[model samples]
Target: MTADDHALALALADAAGAAIRPFFRGAWSEERKADRSFVTEADRAAEAAMRALIEAHRPADGIIGEEYGTRNEGAGRQWVLDPIDGTTSFIAGRAIFGTLIALVQDGWPVLGVIDQPIAQERWVGRIGEGTTFNGRPAATRPLKDLSDAVLGTTTPHQFAGDDVDAFMGVARAVAESKIIYGGDCYNYGLVASGHIDCVIEAGLKLHDFAALVPVVEGAGGMMSDWMGNPLDAGSDGRVIALGDPARLDDILDAMS
Candidate 1:
């Protein structure tokens, strides 16, 4: 990615944050999506703002947004967005929900930004470069063993069938009372900042996770599918983000 691309990614996050701040903890329209997930006026507005800026700055690039469908299909570069990743947290007046933005090129994510407007915390990541949290360098904390690691995920309800069993296996391996719920995209940011060791989840869409890979990997961590494959557009929704890569095999063993 070029310097201008990075600038544009930050600008997109800024626009999305501005559009979402007015609705946080305030009155706004809300409804359930076909998937039974919640959607709000703020989500739509934030994505619209980002799309407008993308169109103005790089009309050739494509877009895949949660609120709005895809545009400029088949383009080599695409912007994937989730205006508010944790709608439940947002509806509950929490600041942990975040706006996720990603730039995917040739089916691989090259840049990502996770913006929590309410908290005014932002994490930016680019391939081949270090990650930054609010302009400061960000890095994950090292852990020597799974028993000492802290784990996080948005909710156990997101898992079902075998996915639930797999998640429980990982939870059981971690220290007692070390698992946290209800951070959504914010949890990955915490992983990047060394405040959380890992996050595991399933049924995530491209918009839900496209931005997380770069941020976590750039901060000396690793993100992959449940079976330890690199995440790309074609991978299944199962995800694992680890602050300490050495623990991957242990986590995978636990999952199995």
Candidate 2:
């Protein structure tokens, strides 16, 4: 992606953040979806705002969003968006929720942005360019051993059937005291910022994981599914992120 593409990604994130900020901590109506996920007017408004901006600025680019479905499916350039990634947290009035924006060219992610409107913090990343927190460079902290690594997940309940057993096997391999929970997308950002060492979770959708690839990789981390495959639109929902590339095989082994 070009420098302008990176800027456009950030602008889309900013627009979504602006649309959602007004509803934060304020009274808003919400309803549960068939998948048991929550959605609110804030989510719709933010996504609509982003879609309008993209339509106006990049008319040819396709769009995929959480609140709304896909559009212009075969366009070579597509933007993936999750206007309010952690709606459960957002409704609970927690600032850990954020907006996710990614630009996928030819089915490969090339740029990403994770923006926390309440905290006023954003991470922008692109292929070949290191990630930046706010405006300064950001990179992960390297840890070679699982015993010393800090681990995180949004919720253990997300795992079901065989996934629970597989996830626990990997969890037990790490220090029990170091396993933290409930950060949603914030945990991934923390991994990129070097504040966390690893994040593993299951049952994520394309919109949930697509925007995260470039941000984590750009910050010198490795992100993939449990089978050690690189994540893409067609990847399985299971995911593992290692801040230190050297730990990839070990973590994958533990999951296996």
Candidate 3:
């Protein structure tokens, strides 16, 4: 990605944030999709704002967004966006929700940004570069063992079938009271910032996880599938983000 690409990604986040701030904590129309997930006016508005910017600034590039569908599907570089990653939290007036933006080149994420509009916190990451939180460098904290790790996930309900059992196994491996629930993408941002040791989640979509990989990995962390494979556009949605790469085997073993 070029410097201009990075700037455009940040601009997308800013546009989305501006579109969302007015509806936060204020009354807005909301509906449940076929998957039973909620979508609010704020979500559509934010995504519309971002889509407009992308179409104007980089009309040749593709876009895959949560609220709006894909455009320019055959383009080599695609912008992936989730206007409101934690819509439930946004509806509850929580600031933990974020706008996720990612630049995927040839199906691999090369740039990412997680923007918490309410708190004005932004984490930006690019391939082969350090992550930055609010314009300063960010790094993940060291962790020697799972026993010493603080683990997080959006919710246990996100898992189904054997995935539930797999997640429970990892949860059991960590110390009591060290597991946290319900932060969605914010939890991954925390992992990137070194505030959390790891986050394991399942059933995520491309838009849900594409932005997280760069942010976490660029901050000295690592992101992969449960089987320890690298993530890509075609990943099956079971994800593991570790603040310390040394714990990958232990985490994979615990999950298995």
**lDDT, candidates in the order shown:** 0.94, 0.89, 0.95
Deviation from native of the Cα of residue 75 in model 1, angstroms: 0.2
Worst 10 residues of 2 by lDDT: 1-10
lDDT per residue as tens, model 2, 1-256: 7877787887888888888888999988899988989999999999999999888888988999988889899999999999998999999999999899989888778888889999998988787889999999999998968888899999999999988888887788899999999988888899999999999999898788888888899999989998888888788789998899899888877877
Q: Which stretches of candidate 3 lie over 4 Å from their true place?
A: none
- C-alpha RMSD between model 3 and the true structure: 0.6
Q: Candidate 3 residues 1-256, lDDT tens each?
A: 9999999998999999999999999989999998899999999999999999999999999999998899999999999999999999999999999999999999999999999999999999998999999999999999987998999999999899999989999999999799999998899889999999999999999999999999999999999999999999999999999999999999989988
- Model 2: residues with Cα > 4 Å off, grouped in runs: none
Per-residue accuracy of model 1 over 20-42 as CA lDDT, tens digit each: 99999999999998999899999
Candidate 2 TM-score, true structure as reference: 0.98
- Candidate 1 has its poorest 10 consecutive residues by lDDT at 173-182
Task: Give the Cα error of residue 19 in candidate 2, in Å.
Answer: 1.1
Residue 237 displacement (Å), model 3: 0.5
In model 3, pairs of residues that clash are none
